[model samples]
Target chain A: EPEVTQTPSHQVTQMGQEVILRCVPISNHLYFYWYRQILGQKVEFLVSFYNNEISEKSEIFDDQFSVERPDGSNFTLKIRSTKLEDSAMYFCASRGGRYNEQFFGPGTRLTVL
Target chain B: TQLLEQSPQFLSIQEGENLTVYCNSSSVFSSLQWYRQEPGEGPVLLVTVVTGGEVKKLKRLTFQFGDARKDSSLHITAAQPGDTGLYLCAEARRGGATNKLIFGTGTLLAVQP
Candidate 1:
């Protein structure tokens, strides 16, 4: 079965540095999303992207966060500055359309020190 | 803000045992989905329930959506070691042009042989 794929399974960055998490959703998917989970916490929604624009975002997705579909196959999440609290497992997901179930990637573990 | 609460956060059971996990929310969802995540991996979609009072069975696992569309349940029968993982319930919010999932805290199940 085709699945969502993410790059840089794990990343370690300085507190003030920027980090870009990349994902390649299923080829035919039209909607993409980014979610994060603090260690031992519930997974939290960050943002949803469709048609090269953001459709929805949570409070956690503040000014520091941005998502881009720079190419037909690549979707990326950029964090302007990392903080200790920003360390978490970030997952990328996609769905074919409005009524389809979202498929998730293996996730990228971001560690800020 | 919509929140999904999962009951019995952690469960440890012997092989061949039966168990059920519950997901409750104050807000109604257009659809509810169940996912399983193993350590160091992203969540894998198990099932999606779109209609109120719908039931879907996947081999030994059975999923049910409440009649009110605000709650759901996952029941596993004769669970084996393979069932050991974190189970999450996610709801797709209503009234959005782009669908995004709000995940529950998750139920961690450890099935030992």
Candidate 2:
């Protein structure tokens, strides 16, 4: 089965540095999403993209966060400045066809020092 | 903001035991989905329930949506060690470029061999 894939399985960055988390959703899927899970907390929605634009975003997805489909296959989330609270497991997901299920990638663990 | 709450935040049981995880919300859901996530990996979709009072079974795991569409449950019969993971329930918000998933607080299960 084809699955979403993310790069840099683990990322460590300075508190004020920028980091980009990359994902390649399923080859034919049209919708993409980003979610984060703080250690010991619920997975929280960050943003959703479709038609090459952001569809929705949460409060956590403030000015510091931006998403782009820079190429046909790559969906990337960029954090302008990292913070200790931004450390979490970030997952990328995609949905296609008529199903409600969204397939997820293995996730990128972001650690800000 | 709506929140999905899952009960029994942690469960530790021997293999072959039965278990049930509950996801509840004060708000009604358009649809409910269940996912299992292993550490360092993204959540894998298990089941999706759309209608009120719907029941769907996938092998030894059974999922049911509440009659009011405000809750759902996952019941595992004869669970194996492979079933150990963080189980999450999520609902797709209605209006977005692409509906984004709002996940529930997860239930972490540890099935011992």
Candidate 3:
């Protein structure tokens, strides 16, 4: 079955550096989303995108965070300047037009030191 | 904000045992989903329940949505060591153009052989 895939399974960056987490959702899925989970914490919604625009975002999705669909298949989340608290597992998900079931990618582990 | 609370944050059981994980919330949900995740991997979709009081079974796993749509439960029968992982319950984004999933804190299960 087709699945969502992410690049750079793991990343390490300095506290003030930038990082970009990339994901390629299922080929035909229309809606895309980004979520994060701190160690021993619940997964929190970051943002959602459709029609190449951000549909909604949570409070945690502040100015430092941005998402882009650079091409048909690639969706990316960029943190301009990482913070120690930004260390977590970032996941990307997508859902097709049919049902509400959203498929998730393997996730990108972001480590900020 | 929607908050989903999962009961029994951690569970350890022997092989061939049965267990149930509960997800509860004060806010009613339009749909709920169950996912399983390994240590370093993204969540894998197990099932989605839409209607209130709906029940769906996947092999040895049984999923039920509460009649009020504010709770759900996942029951695993004859669980094996392979069932060890983090189980998450999520509610779909309500009244929005996007379908972001609001996830619970998650339950970590370790099935010993």
Candidate 4:
């Protein structure tokens, strides 16, 4: 079965540096999303994109965060400035036009120093 | 903001045992999904329940959506050690409503042999 895939399975960055996490959602899926989970915490919504626009975003998705679909298959999340507290696992997901099953990628582990 | 609460934050059981994990919320959702996440991996979709009071089965695993669409349950019968993982419940994002899902804190199940 087709699945979502992400690049840079793990990343380590210093505080105040910028980081970009990349994802390639299921090629046929139309909707895309980004979520994060802190160690021992619940997964929190970050943002969603559809029809070449942002459909929704949570409060946690502040100015420091931005998402882009630069190409047909590439979905990316960029953090302008990193902090120690930003360490977490970031996940990317997508849903196709039918059945509405949301598929998830393996995830990118972000570690801020 | 929509919040999903999962019960029994952690569970440990012997192989061939049975267990149930729950997801509850005050807000109604268009659909609810169950996912399993293993260490170092992102959440993988197990099932999706859209209608109130709907039930679906996947081999030894069963899922039920509450009548109010505000809660869901996952039951595993004769669970084996391979069933061990973090189970998460998430509400589907409605169109124009933050395309992101609201996920529960999660239930970590450890099935030992």
Q: Model 1 misses residue A78 by how many Å?
A: 0.9
lDDT of 3 at A101: 85
In candidate 2, how many Å is residue B99 off? Answer: 1.0
Q: How high is the CA lDDT of each candidate model? A: 0.92, 0.92, 0.92, 0.89
RMSD of 1: 1.5
Which one wins on DockQ? 2
lDDT string for model 3 (A14-105, tens) is 99999999999999888999999898888888999999999999999999999999999999999999999999999999987455688999
Taking the tens digit of each residue's C-alpha lDDT, what string does model 3 give over B70-104?
A: 99999999999999999999888753688778889
Instruction: List, residue by residue over A1-113, the lDDT tens digit for candidate 4.
Output: 89999989999999999999999999878889998989888888788999888898888899999999999989999999998988999999998745577788999999999
DockQ of 1: 0.75
Candidate 3 C-alpha error for residue B15, in Å? 0.3
lDDT of 4 at B20: 93
lDDT of 1 by residue, A1-113 (tens): 89999999999999999999999999998989999988988888899988899999988999999999998999999999999999999999998744588899999999999
Task: Give lDDT tens digits, candidate 4, residues B1-113.
Answer: 67789999999999998999999998887888899999989998888898899999999999999999888999999999999999999887675934467688899999999
Residue A6 alpha-carbon offset, candidate 4, angstroms: 0.4
Could you give me the TM-score of model 1 versus the true structure?
0.95
Give candidate 2's whole-model lDDT: 0.92
DockQ of each: 0.75, 0.85, 0.81, 0.69
Predicted complex 2: DockQ: 0.85
Clashing pairs in 1: none
**Clash count of each predicted structure:** 0, 0, 0, 0
Please write out the lDDT profile of model 1 over residues B3-62, one tens digit for every residue: 899988999999999999999999887889999999889999999899999999999999
